[model samples]
Target: MYVINKSRHSAYLLHAHIVFVTKYRRNVLGDLHLDAFKTSAAEVCAEFDAELRECDGESDHVHLLIEYNPKVQLTKLVNSLKAVTSRRLRNQFTDLRAAYDKPVLWSRSYFVGSCGGAPLEVVAQYVRNQRG
Candidate 1:
């Protein structure tokens, strides 16, 4: 059930599993916060011609599965997602903003894993068996 994307010259499929943790590992997110994050994440992914396949989280961290185009720079997308979500959440929930002196929601670092591709060993074996 993987659909390949075609550009003017190339075809590819790319996905990223990203994780963001709350600043100081605070347990501030609840149902309302998670819902808002999902909505905002979908909108942000749309801007980059990507799709947010799934999103879920606990009180302290969130996870997102995104299918995206190869042209998108992973780092920039992650930064934007964090910044936009943080700003929106802080504005929507005054109590959340009050918990921090500075405007911060997610920690500075994040986890991003590339997914949806042939296994590494399989690809390597194929290359080794190449005629030329």
Candidate 2:
């Protein structure tokens, strides 16, 4: 079930699922890296007044489910998440830093999908049935 959240002026429910792949799709992440990433990601989300609801990953990629206010600019949040995580992870993990001569962690691209609330088709049908 989705819960409605509120700010001083509005109430809303918004969520997004995001996926970030390692640069070159490298399988460099281990348990420690994944843990650190969760921590780092949660902090970043909090900075944007969002919540990181869920996070998990494999060696090459990670998934994040974030609940955010409608006012948040997702692209900016994503860029910050990628940049901050890259810098933090590289500095903390020597092997990760050494794994690449170039200073890079995640790829330049990412996947993001809006989620939660009613399905699009369901909402569309409801709208079509409206008397007005």
Candidate 3:
């Protein structure tokens, strides 16, 4: 999963483990909404030239292991994902909108950790193994 991406001047393999929590700790995320969310999130990743390596979630939060090139801005990618996914989910899923009195889907804070330390493929395998 750690295929190297080459630009005109460089080749790189960068991965980020990101977690997004729902606003107000509400149990708004469920099996009913996961597919749409995952699809929308994958499109968002594609928009930034990133790959959605893996995804999993609970009732209120979601975990994503993403692989992207160095050219992409991590903060911009994260923000767009939060905003676009939040807006799309709320618009598509009535239950999620009803779960929140406010219009926000995701909370203001998020978690992102850089992946390194052994090798890129090894880290990818470790993350893939984590799904179970």
lDDT of predicted model 3: 0.88
Error of 2 at 33 (Å): 0.3
lDDT of 1 by residue, 1-132 (tens): 888999999999999999999999999999999999999999999998999999999999999999999899999999999999999999999988987989999999899998878988998999999997
Candidate 3, backbone clash total: 0
Error of 2 at 88 (Å): 0.5
Give a tens-digit lDDT track for model 3, residues 1-132.
355778899988788999999888788788867777789889999999899988889999998888988888999999999999899988998888888778998989999998844777887899999968
Error (Å) of candidate 3 at residue 108 is 0.1
Q: What TM-score against the true fold does each predicted structure earn?
A: 0.94, 0.95, 0.85
**lDDT score of residue 113 within candidate 1:** 97
State how far residue 91 of model 2 sits from its true place (Å): 0.7
- List candidate 1 stretches off by more than 4 Å: none
Best by TM-score: 2
Q: In angstroms, what RMSD does candidate 2 have relative to the true structure? A: 1.1
Q: Write the per-residue lDDT of candidate 2 for residues 57-127, one digit (tens) a residue.
A: 99999999999998899999999999999999999999999888899999999999999988899999999
Model 2: CA > 4 A from native: none
Q: Positional deviation of 28 in candidate 3, in angstroms?
A: 1.2
